[model samples]
Target: MGRIVLNGVRKAFGEVEVIPPLDLTIEDGEFVVFVGPSGCGKSTLLRLIAGLEDVTGGEISIDGRDATELPPAKRGLAMVFQSYALYPHMSVRKNIAFPMRMAGLPEGEQKRRIEAAAKALNLTDYLDRRPGQLSGGQRQRVAIGRAIVREPSAFLFDEPLSNLDAALRVGMRMEIGELHKSLATTMVYVTHDQVEAMTMADKIVVLRAGRIEQVGTPLELYRTPHNLFVAGFIGSPTMNLIGGAEAERHGARTIGVRPEHIASGSPDGAPWVGTVGLSEHLGSDTFLYVHGTGLAETVTVRADGEVPLRHGDRVGLTPNPDRIHRFDAEGSRL
Candidate 1:
């Protein structure tokens, strides 16, 4: 494993500039996730690191060695793609062993490495089976196994779980987390899913329009996002962002309160009042959508299992002041 550095990295296609001059330092063995909306350049940045795309300007180095001009094969990184990219005609064993064979390893070493990777990925039973014979999750594992067999200095994943069903995606997410723990290799994962980024990343890099919005731990981003974009992007059910003028006149500006931070009814020492408009019960908890008062749109609040409130129910909403996030007129945190 080795540290990866990007110094004033940039990419442009003719006159359309995609990534601006950006700087990042990825520590050796760290699991860093790059997350942003589509066309925001997260995948482009990952490709730049993998040597799949060249840097139009700036320098890239791995373990103190400059690698801007190096080809993908010489970059000492393995990339797993969303499509699995398994060979339909080759058995799982052959597919996993292909990289080793290409590298011209001894027969004994290649066989041993393939067996070890297959065992680690729980694919020993499917070694003789082709990609066509395995399930979606199994096929993804084969793709991962192929990367593992190469034993590169770092692993790059580009939405590797996007192709799987919800349950399988969760399972594969856990598998990838476990694999990182066991291997402890440098990893850079690119995804638009905030849930995946939050749950699996040791550090999260939130991007917007080819620029980095913020970089921090999951909870750090959740608890204290630097601006409105991040405040809205990092959480589920999203955050309720009231306008700065309206909020400040009421003692706060651009007030942000999470769904889980709001409670039903006019609790003692509550901050604001709104009528309930809709409610969603998810077994473990209920979400109350409130309207009316200073807020322009429906604001969501979390309730304990099965809120008795219904549509058009006249109820008061209160936000915990300590839990609220205040942002300035420009959306920067205040």
Candidate 2:
């Protein structure tokens, strides 16, 4: 019963409107991620839902009840921030018990929930230790354990993994996803990293400049973006966009081809010719930046990890015609 709906929700600061009116719905037990570049207003929207910030217009409903004006705690939601927010002086057990203690729950209830959350988060053996004694990942788990004990209807995460190193970020991402499965609670997450959004969300809301560009499953946005901004932002290595005469030839204002769709070896007659500018080998795959391509200033091609192509090597690239994405002059999908 954790469904949340926003009807014409908006946010403004003085005379400037940061979030224009928008509508969105998150179903019970669904994991949704709000993602976009910096200053895109994803965090602002999350705060609006959390009741930490009041909406300038319209309403927020939780489980069909209006909660727009409710204070953060009264809204029955929990939020995990980018910072761990754990009390350094408190032991893991006490840190997790803080929220229950504040609410004046009985000592027995607090102990029960804390133990359950600790075991669930793999912190059972570390309960006696303080936050300063744990690694970054363990400390984050303690923070999550604190949230889990509250048992809120929905959980809101504000870039929870941003503080971790790359390897730890990956681990925590999977851990959070697993937590969602085990808890089966509605979760709304915010991040600027598309990779995190793709890996963790059941539904993804892509925002830019306070507006939602698109909302759908990760594959939906990746396979069929609504417009140019979405097409360019949703993929890794990004989709290559070409304009000028080359695009005109395709009866479009611009043409887009993903790096993976551009093959290095040309067969018959390929449209792009360039010298490999830089090559990155990551064991699993190779990324080749091709320069001097008349179609675009630089055309990136994803090649096999064992690709023999090197810097300054002349190459021809062929884009899979069926996979090409066409956009109008205003960057709308054609």
Candidate 3:
């Protein structure tokens, strides 16, 4: 329940700059996700906010207080790391209560907070279990619960779901979303998974090479990416990026279109054509990979249901002009 602000934040490891000067405002009780590819500085930014890494320049503030030089504990934030970071020797209850113990809370208040956190995370039955006895997902929950018991001003998650199985990841994602809703606390989650960002975040900060690429809601980034990098990175199956010359001939510098915007056959008001190179039936829809149009690689088109397309099928392809995105030679959106 605190507003977190970063003003001209920067990070560097000796001569190599990791994060360039960046400014972001995270409103109180908002869930903001920082997402990017590996080595793109998302985790670095999270660590900076958590005070795990000191900022090379600029300031970090939480709840109207400047905290640039504060230690991790003094920053009034709890971080749940990717590794869970649970103490293997401690029972679940003890582990979750450790932060309170460190802060010297009275026994009664500590017990009450621990019990409430365990119950909220559905860990009541596993309070006596050690980290060795819990499943990966359970251990992750304990890590989160430990953070919850601290009742910090904000929560920082660094790929907390990366170790879970696919199904567990989905379920835990929902749980985290619910946790945010119920707690109404400021949260900043960093992950390479775009799906996590798209599903959980009220706003997303997309980063690349230590610099921010775009900051917007999931749908806004999906619908209108500001550059080729974001246009290719934000979507499932990714958007198709045709060469500049080819796109310019079609009245655009570089054509970018989503799979769903492309069709298998000649749809009304559609333009561009390519031979269907490969088709994948995904039950609810079909993904057509079209090639041989002077494009760098195959273009994917999402069609409703199966469209009876196959590999090497000579088919005409068309994209909705209104749905097309144009980028300049430098990859900036035109």
Best by lDDT: 2
Native-to-model Cα distance after best TM-score fit, residue 38 in candidate 2, in Å: 0.5
Cα displacement (angstroms), candidate 3, residue 173, comes to 0.8
RMSD of each: 1.5, 1.1, 1.9
The candidate with the higher TM-score, 1 or 3, is: 1
Residue 86 in model 3: lDDT: 87
lDDT of 1 by residue, 263-321 (tens): 67753445567777778888999888888856767888888876788887777676776
**How big is the positional error of residue 236 in model 1, measured in Å on the Cα after superposition?**
0.2
Query: How many angstroms is residue 251 displaced in model 3 relative to the true structure, after the best TM-score fit?
Result: 3.5
User: How big is the positional error of residue 164 in model 3, measured in Å on the Cα after superposition?
Assistant: 1.2
Angstrom error of the Cα, residue 217, model 2: value is 0.5
lDDT of 3: 0.89
Model 2, 258-280: lDDT tens digits are: 99998997523767788999999
Alpha-carbon error at 46 in model 2, in Å?
A: 0.7
Q: Which stretches of candidate 2 lie over 4 Å from their true place?
A: 266-268
* Clash number for each model: 2, 0, 0
Which 10-residue window of candidate 1 scores lowest in summed lDDT? 263-272
* Arranged by TM-score, best first: 2, 1, 3
By TM-score, is 2 or 3 better?
2
